[model samples]
Target: MKLTTKGRYAVTAMLDLALHHKGEPVSLAEISERQDISLSYLEQLFAKLRKAGLVVSMRGPGGGYQLCSDPKEIAIADIIAAVDEHVDATRCGGLGDCQDNRRCLTHDLWTDLSNQIRVFLSGITLADMTERADVRQTAARQVKRLEMVADSAR
Candidate 1:
């Protein structure tokens, strides 16, 4: 499936929030800095996430965004879908119209592949991803790099 930057970045930002939000909200700027995503873009994504009931926002100083539910309850597929992304591998987008208004020879094959991918992603959650050794290591590195950048600027 062709997951776009929107899907990838939404997952990355959510994972960052799950990793860092220890009973507190995490700012979009923090996710933007750690994931190398633009703040404006993050704002857009977070808006959609909030509307989807996956996240909530706060105002005033010391305020930011927090997960609306447990990370384990938030599936990767849900995040992708919240951002209006599809996990289709078919050239016809599963509409069976790949060739001149008709189903192509491999339409079923691609459709089945898309279903498998959706199911695979649906089984994985932000909490599950946060428990990975590699995810922890990568988050640590991103935090260290951000710290170094802040120090250099001072």
Candidate 2:
């Protein structure tokens, strides 16, 4: 399946929020900047996420978005679905349209693969990622790079 930037970025942005938010709202701008994602794109994703009850938005100063539940409660598949991302390995989007007016011989194979991917993602949580040392190290490297850039620009 082709996992587009929409799905990848949504996960990246959510992970950033989960890592940075410490009982305070984390602004979309901060997530966009840190994750190197477009602000407008995040806006659209967050809109869907808000509607899906995956996130809660705050207003006024020091306001932004927060996870509606604990990180462990949020599944990767849920985030992907909230953003309307489809994980279909088949060319027909699980519709068996790979062949002209007929189903391809391997239609079921790809369909099963997609379902397995969904299950794999469902089993993963944001909290699970937060516990990964590699994820933390990558984020830390980005933070250090940003700090250096800021210092150099000063």
Candidate 3:
């Protein structure tokens, strides 16, 4: 699959938001620190996400971003799509022009794979990912590490 950093980071940042958005907006700076993603990149991704109606931004003190709906209602596929990322496994991007404007021999296989990937991602929601024990563990670790860094800096 051709899932680039854009798609991966969008999902990661959205998951971070889902995990920490407890009736309050989560800042992109916090997400960037936790996920090791760039703040500027997140800004670009979030602009698209907001436009897609997946998230809403708040302004003023304690301002940041929040999910538009429940995490369970937001599919991973939707997040990826919101960032203009495609889950295509085909070289031709499912356009059936893999070989000189003609369908390649393995075009069908790749197209099917792409469809399967899309379906798999669509079936998974941010809530589903948040429910995973390993995810929680990793998030806790990230928080602890940040705390340690802060303590050292103080």
Give the per-residue lDDT of model 2 (tens digit) for 1-154: 7999999998999999899889999999888878899999999999999999999999999999999999999999999999999998998888777899578999999999999999999999999999999999988888888888889999
lDDT of 1 by residue, 1-154 (tens): 6899999999999999999999988999889899999999999999999999999998988788999999999999999999999999999888888999999999999999999999999999999999999999999999999999999999
Q: Lowest summed-lDDT stretch of 10 residues in model 1?
A: 56-65
Give the poorly placed runs of model 2, Cα more than 4 Å off. Answer: none
Off by over 4 Å in 3: none
lDDT, candidate 3, 1-154, per-residue tens: 7789999999999999999998999999999999999999999999999999999999999999999999999999999999989888888878889999999999999889988999999999999999999999999999999999999999
Candidate order, TM-score descending: 1, 3, 2
Per-model RMSD to reference: 0.7, 1.1, 0.7
- Candidate 3 to truth, TM: 0.98
Q: Estimate each model's TM-score.
A: 0.98, 0.95, 0.98
List lDDT for all candidates, in order. 0.95, 0.93, 0.95
Off by over 4 Å in 1: none
Q: How many backbone clashes does candidate 1 have?
A: 0
Give one clash count per candidate, in the order shown: 0, 0, 0
